[model samples]
Target: IDPGHGAQDAGAIGNGLLEKNINLEVALKLQSRLHQAGALTVMSRTSDTFDSLQTRVSKGAQASADIFISIHANANDNSGANGTETYYDTTYAAAHSVKLAQQVQPRMVSALGTKDRGVKTAGFYVIKYSRMPSILLETGFVTNPIDASILKSTAAKDRLASGIATGVSNYFDVK
Candidate 1:
């Protein structure tokens, strides 16, 4: 499910790219691709509006989704740190989450040709609250010029979606 940041909270912003927008775009595309692959999908948000993190988690849980992935972009004050990273909840020992990250990270890096940031555990709200194997993927660094260009391109976005879909398919052991 996609978590759209709005109202008071603005996620990461750089090079006129907002994390919220990127999240929605990638989530929509991923949903479409997953549907094409015969996976049932649901989105927490379909527009540029705001919803609480709890609400997003509730929706996913209520749906009984097999996996929940929250899409996002990264930023840093340094403006030099750039890469793709997927995160899972530190408190959860879900093998599938790690497996999904392992499957997705290489594909994302291959498509973007960005730094391999590796996977890590974090107590992110979405990951923490999700019941199923969940991941929060930071697709790229918006503050970095090279990464920003890739993030802004439609081709790169499609590649990102396809890579993520491939990762999901791998995780589910679906051909």
Candidate 2:
């Protein structure tokens, strides 16, 4: 499942690209790729809209999904910062969340050739509220030039989807 955004909370923006749109696009692509890989998938949002954090968490819980991956793009004051990073809730003891991130980070970095912004822990709303193993992936710094270019490309987006699908398959041991 994917969390749209913080709701009424427009995430970061760069080069006239809104973070919300990037998140939705990546989430949709990830859903499609995962389905093609024979994994059942669901998304918290499929359009340009806002969803409350509680609603997203509730949806995941209701689905009783094995894993939840929240797709998002990063932004920073330092436009030079660029990389793909994943996050798991620090309070959660689920190793799968971290392991999933570990499995995907390399693929993202390799496919996009972006900086390797190592996995980190955060008390993100989505991760914190999710009952199942959950991860929030920051695909890249939308504020950065190089990263922005990649985000705008269909090829790069598809590559990101493939990497995410590969990671999920690895996590579930789905051949």
Candidate 3:
């Protein structure tokens, strides 16, 4: 699990919420859920510390994780662009990434009751270099008031984490 940003790199900030904090909270929740389910999880950072993008990819690769999931909160200058989306790097592991995103996106929408921005292809460094079924999940746009509210709620974060964990289990047929 890779939480998007930390420390000096605070990522997106809006409505009194820091994207880095939200990312870590959700990532930790997901890590706990996966652990309780008997799945091994390797976290890029378990605290409010920074990890280089290359280091994040290295951790996933070094662990030989079956899937790499990067948790993030989105930001939009428009502030009206609100929704949940998942990203996969088509230049790398397109098919597996897409499969993971397909399983994850709708569940996120359903769990958070957020707009469905659907899955997209991007060349995010961590996901692109992971060499596995990798997905970078934008939980919601922090710049949007509605999304910011949802992202700030503990219940919503747990739901988001649960949804992602369920998606991962579904991807691996864990059960």
Candidate 4:
């Protein structure tokens, strides 16, 4: 599991919520859930620390992770751009990455009741170079009032974490 940004890199900031903080919180929750389901997890950073993109990819490669999921909150100059989306890169593990993204995308929308921005292809540094199936989840747009409200709620975060965990289990056909 990789939380998007941290420490000096606060990621996107909006509505008084730091994307880094939310990313870490959701990542930790998802990690706990995955652990309960008997999945061995590796986190890029377990605390409020920063790691370069290459470092994150190296950690996953070193651990021989089956799948790499990076958690992040989105932001937009236009606050009206609000929704949940998942991204996958075609450079490596393309098909599996798409499948993993498809699994997580709707679960996020269902969990958060946000607009479904759908799964997309992107060349993000982490997902692009990782040899394993990889996905980056834009949980919601923090700049939007509705989405921000949902993201700021503790109960919603738990549901979002559960939704993501379920998606991973579905991808592996595991309980």
* Highest TM-score against the true fold, candidate: 4
Kindly give the stretch of ten consecutive residues in candidate 2 with the minimal lDDT sum: 1-10
Sorted on lDDT, best first, the list reads 4, 3, 1, 2
For 48-101, candidate 2 gives per-residue lDDT tens digits of: 677788888888888888888888899999999889998998566467788877
lDDT of 4 by residue, 1-175 (tens): 9999999999999998999999999999999999999999999999999999999999999999999999999999999999999999999989899999988899989999999999999999999999999999999988999999999999999999999999999999941
List residue ranges in candidate 3 displaced over 4 A: none
Provide the TM-score for each candidate, comma-separated. Answer: 0.94, 0.93, 0.97, 0.98
Model 2 steric clash pairs: none
Q: Write candidate 3's Cα lDDT for 1-175 as tens digits.
A: 9999999999999999999999999999999989988998999999999999999999998999888999999998898999999999977678878998999899999989999999998888998888988999999999999999999899998998899988888878732
The digit string of per-residue lDDT tens for model 1 on 1-175 reads 6755754566899988888888888889899999999999989888877888999898889998888898889999989999999898855546877887888888888877889999999988989878788998999998998899899998998998998899889888942
Error (Å) of candidate 2 at residue 146 is 0.9
User: Model 1 shows how many backbone clashes?
Assistant: 0
Model 4: worst 10 consecutive residues (lDDT sum): 166-175
Model 4, residue 4: C-alpha shift (Å): 0.6
Q: Which stretches of candidate 1 lie over 4 Å from their true place?
A: none
